[model samples]
Target: MNEKFTGIVLFIRPHREKDSLVKIFTREFGTKMFFVRGLQSPNHPLKKHLIPLTEHRYWGTINQQGLSFLKEGQTHNLFRSIQSDPFKQAHAAYLSQLVDASIDDNSEDQQLFDIFEAALCSLNEREDARPIQLLLQLKLLRRFGLRLNMNSCVVCGSSQKIEDFSMTHLGVLCHNHLDTDPNRMRLSYKQIKILQLFNEIKLNQLGHVSISDQSYKRIDELIFMIYHEQVGIKLKGESYLNQLYKVADQLKVSKIEGT
Candidate 1:
């Protein structure tokens, strides 16, 4: 049965020599593996559409149980901007890996799909990828079953006078509740606001995504702490991005010293 569906290529892998398997997260059907014959052949027609981080409208055989197959497909979005830029490419890869890990096979989640699609579009359109990256990461925490308490103190549920972030409480902490967790992370006034903003960010209607360098660094520290202590998922995309940042920083320092 041939059916058309829109999907994003999460990753691709080699199958028995010359063949390949693509894991695609579809709007209609959560995630499925598509087997392609002669994918590595010299003149494969579907080669361009099958690249990672690209979305396509595919007419493939739908399988409820095992491996499905792709007949043909068309480009849904080339994501040309992301394709051309390394940082954006890294963000796309990281988001794709996060989305892939957070969902189950063949499970339809319209909310997850919609936000993820929006994030991809936002990433492709925006000059700064960090904002979108942070938004998506904060949004996906609920899906990962590690929702942080942003509204009030996690210990006493007090909404007033929220002073710091408690890693032990896995949420915010009020001034009164600070001693409850001795390891609470002290957040500046701006850092607290940005965390709330990120947690409540709307992907499709994003506007003027801006944060100061200092606050942005602090926000990442908080988000990363949650992932490290609670979520605990390590991704190759993240590892690559870290290395890329290191190289970029080194280059900047070298340029400064040479001047």
Candidate 2:
């Protein structure tokens, strides 16, 4: 009684003794857990083969409790670009944790799986990972039913060019729309345009657009506010990027004020 499927390792944990419990997001069966007997043993196939984020074609079973054992696993590329760079590695780990936290077991969503696969591959191959990260977050939120309106102001439903925008209420609260939330983020037209572009453009096409340093800061704040409201958890990766920008901002201000 066994089932065979292809999956990507999302997370792995050591089990009792030499065993390990591996969590994988599979294309056929969605997220699942498998207990690999003697996974740590030198002779075990998983000992040298299995790793986080590695794609594997596995033969296992869905028992009463959960999936168990590993008959065979063929490992594909380990994404050396992600593994080699510290920043990329950290971002990949963060993305993996987010996906692992959000995706549920025994549910198959091929679209979501494809999006995640595309995102990981893009991050590994892309020269700049920021746009890919942004796109992934947006797509993930949308898949979870938290859709933000990029085409128009959610309050006024105006398709007109938005001059001033806010993210507290999860959309472009236009100039006339009163900000009920005190923490509503006010963004420039350029910031809104970049966000709109990010929503529309493909990862490879993002290189065509140019965003200013000031605009990126505003977009970062808007994304943080929007994602926090939707997910109810502040992303440390966003905070880390914000801190770096904050330091640069302080330096810039110091030079301007000669303090």
Candidate 3:
């Protein structure tokens, strides 16, 4: 019997000469791998719908052992605009890979699916994808139960001014407790406020908030550190993302110099 699923393609790998194995994060079934025969064929109708970050309606059959076989698929949203820009494309790749690595197979989480959908749509529409990326990472971290306690000092439970962030304590450290962890990263009150904003706001409501590049960098550093120390998974796309950002910065500099 065949089952129908609507999901985004997270990752794809070549299987033999003519087939491909795809990892899809579905709203109904969470993450699942599907075997698609003739996916690499020149005339395959589903070829265009198999790209990473593209949403599709997948029709397939699951074997008794629980492997999915793709019968047919139709595109839901190709997000062509995201593919048109190299920077957006790289970020999309990063997001897809991150989600694919972090979430377990057959683990259905509708909230995560919703967040990823909103994030991909937002990235396709927004001029600057960094802020949305940051927001999405924060949301994912929270969803994974690795959330940082920004509400108060984790060490002393003080809601007063936070002076630093401690990976050991898993939250902000007040000035009084700053000495408790020498390895803590110092954070200004403004930075703490920005992080709080990130935690409180929804991905779709990010237009009302603005973040500086310096602030984003700091937050990203902290969040990536948290992922490393807490979650212990290194995102495979980080190096490529760094290269893309460097190239984008150079292009911006060149355009500014020309003007």
CA-RMSD of model 1: 1.6
lDDT agreement of model 2 with the native: 0.71
**TM-score: which candidate is best?**
1
Cα RMSD for candidates in order: 1.6, 4.2, 2.1
lDDT of 3 by residue, 38-115 (tens): 888988888887888889998887543466888788889988888898888888888887777667888887878888
lDDT of 1 by residue, 17-109 (tens): 999999999999899999898999978988987999988999989998899998889998979999999999998999999999899999987
Candidate order by lDDT, decreasing, is 1, 3, 2
Each candidate's TM vs. the true structure? 0.94, 0.80, 0.90
Model 2 Cα lDDT, one tens digit per residue, 62-165: 65356656778777657878878755666676677667656777788777777777778878887666677776666677656777777777777887856555
List the pairs of residues colliding in candidate 2. Answer: none
Q: Lowest-lDDT window of 10 residues in candidate 3?
A: 62-71
lDDT scores in order: 0.86, 0.71, 0.82
